[model samples]
Target: MSITAATGVPVIEPASVPVLELKGIGKQFGAIRALHGVDLTVRAGEVIGLMGDNGAGKSTLVRIIAGNFPPSQGTIRFDGREVHFHRPVDSRAVGIEVVYQDLALANNLTAAANVFLGRELKRSFGPIRLLDHRAMETRALELFQELRSETRPHDLVKDMSGGQRQAVAIARTRLSNAKLVMMDEPTAAISVRQVEQVLGLIHRLKEQGIAVMLISHRMPDIFAVCDRVVVMRRGEKRADKPIAESSPEEVTALITGAKEAA
Candidate 1:
């Protein structure tokens, strides 16, 4: 704690606060309700696995958090301050980043080019500015090294494997110093070794005090990296607990509605 300048009162550091918090979150689309009474909390350096079947409101909830849309009713607090996001940029401005299932990379571009796609570095010698390829490649190399990935900065993304592509996307997030990262099915169609690579990257993010929310249907992936599991069914949250206290069988039952909320 630190003393406040004016009142001389102690102030708690932000490290003690939760990174993301949702209270009574709900969403509706016309006559249909996509989510209802969902509450969640994520702390720094924690990984949460969000699992559910189709139409379980998983996508809807993610969209809301990503600022694709706003919740019909709820309070979203980030770093202990309530915020309302009207657009995706708003969320990104607050250190929230999302990596969709597609991995959204320009296959025609090199790893370094892709990493600096929209926010490319530039240098000026007079009135003209040129793209700083060397600087970008150097920074991209550093990011790949930080993640312990073997991806080469100058390699074409189209020639890279699924795991390497993931590294490029994740490297972009690192460039933003993102506080929360929401990953959608990162290991969907990768080889066993590649899956391990991705999981290792997740571990690296946690080690750096970044909060991760992994949305995946693969049981093993979730069990492998998540500190806690949250299951959604029929637009409502069915279970939220530590990974050790829950089993795959129980989660399956929850998703299928064979068992009620736990």
Candidate 2:
């Protein structure tokens, strides 16, 4: 099936049997239609890049997948089964975690505390509930080591570098056994060095057999880490193709809705 972007929309190819599939997905807000007949699929062990210009419905789509908003019309399927996600918690229960561009981290909290923020370990002492600080710290350190992350569990998030904070976020998601991680412009606010580190982390995520949906406008990064590219335009899917099959120029044309001469 093909997804065409409207007026200013891009044209992207479609993938096969995505681990996550949105069939004829759509969302409407009063008189404004945010999305229409959009279909998408993400497969395991693949980094699918979702590219689009501003107002291209990328955020809307991510929100829908992340369960921030339910689609007004369409069916969402995960692992070949139809599923309804009413909230972010529902998405998490199904192993879908989203890391927004903001890299939501509590600056005042230590790395360990930030990583295990909501799901902290606890101990029971004869009717008294106690936070298991030691256990949490130990597991946080272990998780960092497993990811080859250099940040210390005791490091204050405010004192850590941008990349370090990013690492903490990713580690937290992994700790929750996330099967699919959606990163929105993960490299947006970091230094060049940190961008490299994040790219390496993305590759590592795939190696661990976790599917990733990366939303970025950086063509080089897309070509570098993503196995396939899915472009969106004007609230619609434009193209979804293997990285090797399409060139940067071709993809750009798709995004801008510039048709090639016959």
- TM-score, structure 1 vs. true: 0.94
Best by TM-score: 1
lDDT of each: 0.95, 0.87
Residue 168 C-alpha lDDT in model 2:
94
Q: For residues 43-137, could you state the per-residue lDDT of candidate 2 as single tens digits? A: 88989998988998999999999999899999999878899989999989888999988878999999999999989999999999999999989
TM-scores of the models, in the order given: 0.94, 0.90
Error of 2 at 167 (Å): 0.6
Model 2: which residue pairs collide?
11-238, 11-239, 12-238, 12-239, 12-240, 13-239, 13-240
lDDT per residue, candidate 1, 1-262, as tens digits? 8998999999887667899999999999999999999999999999999999999999999999999999999999999999999999999999999999998899999999999989999999899999999999999999999999999999999999888999999999998999999999999999999999999999999999999999999999999999999999989999999999999999999999999988
Question: RMSD, each candidate, Å?
Answer: 3.5, 9.1
Q: What is candidate 1's CA lDDT for residue 172?
A: 94
